[model samples]
Target: MQLKQELIQQIQSIIATAKERAIRSVDTERVLMYWQIGQVIQEEEQQGKERAGYGEFLIKSLSETLQPQFGSGFSVRQLEMCRQFYRTFPNTNALRSQFSWTHYRTLIRIENQDKREFYIAEAAKNNWTARQLERQVNSQLFERLLLSNDVKEVLAVARDEKQPSDAKEIIKDPMVLEFLGLKREAAYYEKDLEAAIITHLQEFLLEIGNGFSFVARQKRIHIEGDEFSIDLVFYNRLLQCFVLFEIKTTKLTHQDIGQLQMYVNYYDRFEKQEFENPTIGILLCADKNDAVVKITLPENNKTIIASKYQLYLPTEQQLIDEVKKEIEKLDHDKMNE
Candidate 1:
């Protein structure tokens, strides 16, 4: 009976694996077929003597002809997308097999080549589904990273051509917490915000950037009969350090900075192993004044970071403003030096 059960389990595993492989094979072939159709359409369009609106006419006619034969996938919009896909990825070798048509559709919408490539590399490395990839794109992960570092170097790290040596590479300044289901206008306590983060811990981790795993919540520590409870604790494998987070529902102040710094010192002194890097502390706040943060921390400080959390996504103008502020802060720091 035991031998029979084992045989059945092994056969089931084999069937499941084979089915997954077959689906992947079909998807890959379908992607290639679309690419080929796109190529033919582009070639014929280029050869046409009539230049004005000829391409549009061609796509429309082709969509009408193919829709009857190939069904809804050959709609005008899809055909146009396929054409744009070929234009964006001129070389067939550059197309990644792991990406489905939906993934490419999202990728092609990105106007910046470097940003597009970065997302592709990151999505592939992280094994993000189409929906996940779309979310990352909408959140403007590339733009947020560029807020604190050189674009060229950041792109290099995204491509895995270089490794991150500091926490800045793994952290975003203003994290979007739209998934937390919180209202911006609603008054909430620090503990409430912390609870939301804990409830949506997976999304929070993803928003915090990669390589982080949740450790503890309201972690208790004692010093000289005084008790302190840290809001959240995480371990970052890439940085090989314990990442501590303090939740602040209101605007950040010097006291908040000092508290986070103290927590960081405690971790480094007692919790962190000598082989690991120093613990990094983050104050996740609703608002922060950059000047106050700069004045509070030591001139050479790298341990504590204060980042704002937003309940909703920022508009394009808001993103631009954020970037400008970041650049100005960097300039101000340079001048102070």
Candidate 2:
């Protein structure tokens, strides 16, 4: 019996090692291929005196010839991607050996270099699959970071080895709640939205951003015979903090902020460990007045955040304009300061 157990263990160990080695080998080979493809495209472009059209023509010709011999991957679009792949990562040695070609395909589509680099580092560090990377990108991860921080802080968080420390790092504003199937104009109570979120909790968490895990809903608290129930509670592994949320179907009031503050204080005093940071409170409301929130909270309040929730996805242009306006307002405030 002992001998059989040992043999089985040995086989398992061998299989694990073989799988690890195989993955590494595949990664290395793919990285090398990308580098070589980049090199070939760069050389051809230079030969043609760096004319843009020359590269396109070369890809067209190459695709026509190579597709028959190599099957599906040699399409003109892919060849163009190879050229872009080289342009994006001019340093072959800098290519992350951990990610596959599909990962690069997603990264190359991100036009912002800083955002692209951030995704690359994160994807490699987290060992994220191509699909995960796609989801993160589609969720506007870069824009969320930018909204929460300055350019320097955003870049540092993206590139540095340290985990993000701020509450805003984990909080996503205007969180996509499309999975709830709630109509924007439809009149619904807070309970309806809360129920929908609970039903589609996993998708909601992804929309909420990284490091969030649901803890409880309508968590009952009793203190001195007075009872209170929080709408939702979550723990963020990345921020190492407990996040408390309050849902509101109407425009947020100062009273709502005060109530959330009380919840935050209670959690900090009783629930949070000494090692963990103070609990964060978020008011997820249909509408919020930035001026009211600023006045209601302490001057240096980091634990409390107010976010507006939308039932439906806004048009891309509308989102862009809103972001632009916010940036302008921030800049104006900075100037006054």
Candidate 3:
């Protein structure tokens, strides 16, 4: 009976693999077909003798004729999208077979070529689904990273031209936790927030970015007869170190920073292996004062980071304003120097 069950399980796995491949093959063909259609439309527009208003009329007429026989997928909007797909990715070789039409549509909408390219590379590397790609784009993940790092180097890492050597490359500030279903105005205990995070561990992991796996919660530690509990602990395989997190329900303070530093020291001295990198400490709080953080940490400090957590997603304008403020501060400091 055991042998029969093993044989049946193997057959089921084989069938599942074949089915997935078949779906992927069909999706790739559809993507290619759309690109081809866009190419033809672009060529026709270029060849037309009268350029003014000709493109609109061509798309309308084509859509009317095609929609009748080929269905609504050939609507003017879709044709325009196809044309944009080709325009955004002019070289056919640049298109990946793994990406579906949904992915291309999302990519083509990004106006900045560099940011678009970064998203494409990240999506492919992370194997992000269409919805996941959309979420990251909407969240302005690229802009957030640019706040602290060089754009050229970040893009190079995204494109696989360079590698990230530290945890800072993967961590994002003000991580959005709207998916946790926590009320923004509601006052909750750190334990409650920790519970929510564990309940939505999958979503939390996704929000935390790649290479992180949850290790423990309320992890107890004893040092010199003093006991302490860590809010959360994670291991980042890419950085090859333990990641320690502490949750604060209010604005970060010097004491909070010091306490986290102590935990980090404990891990570095006792928990971490000699081969492992130094443990990275993150303080997730409701608010963060950059000036406070700068003043509290040593000038050479790199292991500890304090980031804000938001219960809701900020509006697009809010993100833009924040970026502008950051840039202006940098410029002001340079002028003062």
Candidate 4:
């Protein structure tokens, strides 16, 4: 019976693997097909430059001919998308095979070259599904990262041109937790939020940034007959450090920062391996004032951060305003320095 069970398991594994490969193969071929079609359309349009509306006319005519034969995949909108995809990613060598047509579909819509490139590198590195990539794009992940880091550093980290030495390089402030299915108006306890995080750990990890793995919940520590329980703990392989979280369901105060800092100090002093990077602390708060946090932490502080958690995803206008505010703050900090 045991031998038969093992054989069944091995066969199941082989079937699943084969199915996955087959899907990948089909997706890759479809992407190549679309790219080639787009290339032909672009070349033909250029060849008929004598006509003013030739490009638009050409796409419509091609779609009319192909859609009836090939189904809606060759419809006017899809064909236009194909042309745009080819235009956005001109180099055939640059197309990543892991991406599906959906991934390229979302990517081609992005107008900014840097933002598009950043998402491309990050999506490829992280193996984000089309939905995951779309969520990050909608959440304004790139713009949020720019709140603390400059454009050059952000791009470099995304490209893996430089390792992330700072937590801010990857962590986003005002993290979107709409995935938790929590209501915005309702009051939530620290435990409630903590439970939600654990329940949706995968999405939480994606929102938090790269290279994080769950470690412990209500992580307890002892010091000279005293006891304390940290809210959550995570290990970041990229940063080579333990990240401790202290949840606050209200506006942040200095005490919150102090408490998180203590946990960070405890981790660094007692839990951290000698070769590992310093343990970092994050105060996940309902709200935060930037000035208060700056005054609470030491000038040279790198380990402690105060990040606001939003129950709902912000509108595009809200994200834009947030970015503008942070840029102004950066300018203010520079002048004070």
Candidate 5:
């Protein structure tokens, strides 16, 4: 009976693998066809000496002819999209087979060449589905990372040109938790938030960035006669260290940093192995003051980080405000120096 069950499972796995490969093959062919269409349209459009009007007429006429026989996939908008796709990724040889037509459409809409390239490398490296790619774009993941690091470092890390040396490289600040279904207006305790995170662990892990895996929550430890609980703990494969998180429902204070520092110290002294890197401490607070954090931690501190959390994704104005704050902080630091 056991042997029969094992044989059935093996057959099921083989069938599933074949089905997935077949889907990927079809998607690859469709992507290639669109790129070819785009190439032809682009060549013909360039041949017309006329400006804007000629390109529009050509695309519209082609769409009308193709839609009748080939269906709505050849609509004017789609043709325009294909044209843009080819223009964005001019080299046919450079087009990634892993990306579907939807992925190409999303990438084509991004006007910035460098940003597009970063997303392309990251999407390919991470094997992000079309919807996952779209969510990251919509959530402004790239811009959020840029809030602390510069474009050069961001792109280099994504392209594997440089390995991440700091937690800030991989962990995003002001993490958006709109996926938790927690209402922005509603107040949540640290425990409630922790429960929500446990429920939506997958999305939380995705938003937290790469190379992280969950370890424990409310991890209790006793030091001599005293007892303490750590909110959350994770292991980062890339950094090769244990990440300790302490959640705060209100604004971060010096005490919060000190407590988290204690947790980090405990892990480093007792939990960490000699082969592993130092444990990293992170405070997921509703709000945090940069000045307070800077004052609390030593200038050479690398293991401690305080990140703000938001229930909802920020609006355009909110991002602008955050950028302004970053600039002001830089100016303030320079002046203090």
Candidate 6:
């Protein structure tokens, strides 16, 4: 019986290893093929004999021939992608083996080279699947990073050589909770939003960005013979600190900030290990008064953060405008300094 169990376990391990290798081999081959296709397209374009229309004609002809012998992978659109795949990544040696064709297809859509490179490096380092990569790109991760950090820091982190060391680097403002399916106009309580977050914890964490891991929901803390229940608690591996979150369905007020500060103090005093950094608190509210938040928290405060939350995704124009406004504000502040 023991011998049979050992044999079965060995067979399973071998099969798993074989499957992993097969997938990697196929991915590498596909990437190389795209690189070669791109090289051919570039060479053809450089040849003055082909002219503009000739290149299109050549691709169409190639697709027509290959589609019959090959499979749907040889469709005209996919062939064009192969050409672009090469054009976008001119250096064949620079092509990362960590990414697949789908990853490249999503990346090529990004017009900004710097932004594209950032996404590529991040996706590779995080081992993001194609769908996750698409989400990050669509969510304007690069723009958000630019808003939160200096240009050099953003570039360094995006390139995966270094990570942001401050709380500001990982914290996002007006977190998009579209997955919650809550209507913007609907009147909801704080508990309602907390319930939705708990129900869709995995999706919420992904939308919350990197380094966050679920710790507890409705985490109970006792202080001075009184008990307090925090809405959600998380520990950021990157920051090496405990994160306490308080949910508010209405606009954040001084009371909201005060309550969260108390929570942060409690965690810092009682729960956090001496080796860990001070506990951080986040007030996830539906709305906020910027002036009030600024006055309520101390200047250069790092322990507590108050950010707005949106039940739905904002329009692309809105995101662009917001980023532009933030950049303008930074410029104004820098000029004053």
| Candidate 6 local Cα displacement, residue 101, angstroms | 1.0
lDDT against the true structure, each candidate: 0.89, 0.82, 0.89, 0.92, 0.90, 0.83
lDDT of 5 by residue, 29-128 (tens): 9998988899999999999947768999999999889999999999999999888888888888998989998898888888987888888988998899
TM-score of every candidate relative to the true structure: 0.95, 0.84, 0.94, 0.96, 0.95, 0.90
Question: TM-score of model 5 relative to the true fold?
Answer: 0.95
Model 4, residue 195: C-alpha shift (Å): 0.6
TM-score quality measure for candidate 3? 0.94
Residue 254 in candidate 1, Cα distance off native in Å:
0.8
Worst 10 residues of 6 by lDDT: 41-50
* Count of residue pairs whose backbone atoms collide, per candidate: 0, 0, 0, 0, 0, 0
Where in model 6 is the C-alpha error above 4 Å? 1-3, 183-185, 328-337
Better of 1 and 4 by TM-score: 4
Best by lDDT: 4
Per-residue CA lDDT of candidate 6, range 1-337, in tens?
Answer: 2569888999999999999999999998988987797788668767845466887887888889988999888888888888888778888778888888888899988888888878887787778989888877776767766666776777686575676577777677768887788998999988888888889998787777678899998999888899989999999987889999999888889998999999998888888898898999999988888769878999889888887888766677877887888778778778977
Q: Please write out the lDDT profile of model 1 over residues 1-337, one tens digit for every residue.
A: 2568888999999999999999889988888888888888889999983789989999999989989998999999998888888899989999888898788889999989889989998888888888889988898888888888787877777788877788898698889898899998999999898888889998888889878999999999998899999999999988899999999989999999999889999999999998999999999999999889988999788889999999987777888998888778788878977
Cα lDDT tens digits, model 3, 1-337, are 2569888999999999999999999999999999999999999998983778888889999999999999999999999999999999889999988788898889999999889989998999888899888888887888877767778977987887866676667787768888789999999999999999999998788787678899999999999999999999999887889999999999999999999999999999999999999999999999988879988999778899998888887787877887888888789878977
Any residue pairs clashing in model 2, and if so which?
A: none
Better of 4 and 6 by TM-score: 4
lDDT of 3 at 104: 88
Write down the worst ten-residue block by lDDT for model 3: 160-169
* lDDT at residue 121 of model 6 (Cα atoms): 75
How many residue pairs clash in model 5? 0
Tell me, by TM-score, which candidate is best.
Answer: 4
Q: Which regions of candidate 2 deviate over 4 angstroms?
A: 1-28, 50-52, 161-165, 179-187, 311-316, 331-337
**Residues 237-285, candidate 4, lDDT per residue (tens digit)?**
9999999999999999998898888888888899999999999999999
